[model samples]
Target chain A: MRENLLDVENLTIKYKVKNGNLFFNRYREFKAIDQVSFNIGPSETLGLVGESGCGKSSLARAIVKLVGLDSGKVTWLGKDWTSSHASTDRKFRENLQLVFQDPLASLNPRMTVSEIISEPLENYRKDLSVLEKIELVKKSMETVGLSTSMINRYPHEFSGGQCQRIGIARAIILKPKLIICDEPVSALDVSIQAQVINLLKDLQKRFSIALLFISHDLSVVKHISDRVMVLYLGRIMEIANVNDLFSNPSHPYSQALLSAIPIPDPIREKERKRDNLVGDAPSPIFPPSGCVFRTRCKKSTNICSIKEPREKIVKLGHRVACHHVSDEESK
Target chain B: MNRLLEIKDLSVVFDTPDGSVKAVNNISLDVDRGECLAIVGESGSGKSQTFLTAMGLLADNGRSAGIINLNGSDLLNMQRNDLNKLRGNRIAMIFQDPMTALTPHMKVGEQIREVLDHHQGLGKKAACEIIREMFNKVNIPEPDRRMEMYPHELSGGLRQRVMIAMALICKPDVIIADEPTTALDVTVQAQIMDLLNEIKTEIGAAIILITHDLGVVAGIADRVAVMYAGSIVESGEVFDIFYNTKHPYTLGLLNCSLSLEKKIDFLEAIDGHPPNPNNLPNGCPFNPRCKNVRDICREEKPEIKIKKQNHSSACHFELGVK
Candidate 1:
């Protein structure tokens, strides 16, 4: 049996917003993520996908201890790490890393590529000799398709795609057990995006590193992920295997999200039933009561507005959170 | 068929301290009224520069050669005021980032009204009424209520709608939407694209859609021009570009594109990054990345050749209906 590498339960993150007022102290709570739960086994990928302000980034951040979680339990290697997991052991920190969206901005402009790649190694592995650290950095750089000769060049000298390669090299230099990638290829062009996605898959296989891939691009999430989870306004809409989720979506929101992706094949695009979502996503601060997606859902009803729908397993390993799914099951 | 806009051998080059960068190679294409033309390419492919040069919106250091005739009026040699008059009044453009395209301080209604005020010389009361009508036309709920809000007050999707409203407010004959939905999410992108198409039909305006997403191009464009290294390597109808591609670079791009319909085990990525405009390679410019690269491709450039009715491609090898 494949052992679970990391398990997250009931993860919730909220922020106190001022609501654009300075004189008054009236604040409202914005639930960035609510009761989100998932697990990743060794060398597995769990893709978190949603639009902006859906809290996918916040959830990834919370998992890496970059942000405080309002409520949740993070279990790593059978050990529990609560909301305030900062100041934890360095081993835990070394085992988990993150790759951001903007490659150029994520890297340091002043630091040389070699220095930047080895910075993590210098911090985590104090016992490793300088020659060993250099060797590891060189191996990682080559692994991400970066040339070993241009190690002395700065970030500005490289293109957007090359800078992202350097970023990947740094993330994997420490040989972390898990990596949370936050829209890593969103800023890259199509050709460059393919290279980076393939590199991540290759590295994961070679090193057995679990990945938590968060992206607004559903197509990209589908390309590389083994299991996909759809998030809508701080909540999980559906979680299923890649084939099942794309083949048959249970939730209305998931259905809309899938049908909305523009198919590259013109014939399929013309024939497919397209559900064009009208109106914008409501403000996360004033999200509707009960089901957050009720306002945009076609299957919404009085029951949907009164109570948040519990997750229902419609098939093996396919869970959907929608009142309509429950109604069909009851029928 | 009447040509709404015509370009003859248009090229744009920018002068930098390092060297003169040929951002746009000589290219000529005509747009008909009520037709959607898509210019598809990766970064540094000169897709945006071609339109920006024609619109007289190029940077100060950039110089463009050739003729841009809008209704037989020479835009390249026209007076500054005359060119300015033609802009936004007859040829409106929608940018990629909606927030940056709009003024942060001004209200949404005022921004739309300002366009009408400057172009049509209409009074505030009259402009505001027209702006409200446009807001409703774009499907923004509570048009009056949302109009008073500032640009940042609205969400990304809402801001894009306002941009579309402003662009269509003038009722221009030609609309150049340059990566307008790139910053938007998929769901909102679909909504905006639907609105754009619906408005295009209602207004009968020619839309020049410049984007990199093949899916977007396949779905919306009637004709597509595939660009590579500051040149148009292939030009054809949408069906030909997708179903019967004729260029090696275009074939590479189609394989590189991720499709939700047909699932492939691995995407075939074009090996190298887009060439730097300042130092483009010799000969075909795409020879380095071309899969079927030949000895002749490395020695001489290939001109755009007509292979079928309304379809042309630049390549040294045979390519058609593969």
Candidate 2:
């Protein structure tokens, strides 16, 4: 069997909101991640594409066990990490690492670059000497295209892109198999963004690391991701190869998104008709009962409102969650 | 075509302790009446700075040189008070972040009314009536109830609509939108663009769209100016800039743009950072990152060569690309 780097099945994360008269009433549960399942193979890049509050970050945190999962199984190399095994799972921490969205917020301002990179190494490998930790920190910094002499500098001294490189160096110090990079380049300037993207691609090649690159930018995802999963309101709308997803987007939401891209050419732009989704995205506190996309979906019908559309394989590997597309194409 | 706003050799400089930073170098462009001119560039490429400087909206430390003519009247030559009077009344600017732009302490109705009170001869009652109509034009639901709410009470999309409402309340002749929808998500961004397009057509005002996203500029802009390091490296009809791009920087930018088209495994990134404004390179600002860099591009700065009737490019290899 080909070794799957990581497998997250039916993962759900719900935060408890404490309100109503101090300690009197029961706390309400806010479901951030609503039953999502996906996997990353060895040396493969699986993109998790979603908007601001679609629970992409929450799913990343659940995989790292930084946040508690309401229910689901996260398996790494056939080892189950759920309930009893989650806390005791030592391999999970060593194999999985996460880089947060904001570089400035993720990094500790007080700590120097050397200390930030070496922190993980110190925690994971207690047997290693202090000199060895220093060597490893220097090596990882070089891997992310940072200089060793600059290691003594604080996080505040570096630019946004430089700070992200430092963050990547810190994550890779442990040599984790899977890295969940959550909007790593979103906060960066456009020109600096390209630099960081190229660096990530290079590191991914050198380390043979599986990346769960989460982003709202479709362009960035299309460039880095092997396969793309489009999410809307904590539900997967379409899952296909990057080429197929971009070229032949079957789902209406994906089509709308793809059409929304402003072509630099005015004539071509005028020719292309974009069906802008109506109204603001509904609150996730109490999402639509049927298909989550029905509220804004142009093709949503009675069947969609009554029952959630089943995930069907449209192409060899492409999966879509749409009744209209599935039914029309199937015939 | 009659020109609505013509900017000639515009240069905006901010005097700092470090030195004079040329935010917007000697650049010139014209926006015809009812035409949408998109100034496309990345952050610090001087897209917003050009319009801000021309409008006399820059802070005290900032200073601008050259002519900014609105129907032959030198806007730059006008008095500071006159400039302020002409600002919201004639040439209105809408910023990127609407949440921060709107007053959190004041009611939405009162805020929009203040624009009318200063620009137009209208009292609070008359202004309130006009404000509700503007809100309806922007397609804000519950316009009556919304006027009572503060900035914090509305959603991001709603806040942006309110900003649009305020900018269009006086029915300005020119609308300068600086990345109006950049902060919002993709879906909401599309809606905002549609709304802006609708407003432009209904109001029949010239628009200056300043943004980094090429996709957003595609449908709206009539002409496009590709800026790099505070200068217009390429300017032409939007169709020519996108399809028949002359400049290598413009081509690289289009290639880098994420679109509906399935890109190859690797993206074509323009190699280096945009040249620093304060410490700009001697020759071409895009020389370091440009792939088609020649000996001439490295040694001497290239002048803007008029390729077609309206198309212009400042590159050694302008005609080399198809």
Give the candidate number with the greatest DockQ.
Answer: 1
Residue-level lDDT tens digits of model 2 in A127-167: 99999999999999999889899989999988788899999
**Fnat, one value per model:** 0.72, 0.60
User: In model 2, what is the error at residue A131, expressed in angstroms?
Assistant: 5.1
Any idea what lDDT model 2 has?
Answer: 0.85
Poorest 10 consecutive residues by lDDT, candidate 1 chain B: B313-322
- Reference-based lDDT, each prediction: 0.88, 0.85
TM-score of each: 0.98, 0.91
lDDT of 1 by residue, B1-322 (tens): 7688888898999999998999888888889888999999998899999888878889999999998888778989989999888889899899999999999999999888888988999998888889889888888889989989999999899999999889898899889999989999999999888887787688889999999998888778889999988889999999998999899888888887887766776788889899998988888999888777778988998998898999998887776422
lDDT digits (tens) for residues B119-211 of candidate 2: 887998888889888888898988889999999988788899999888888888889999999888888888899998997788889889998
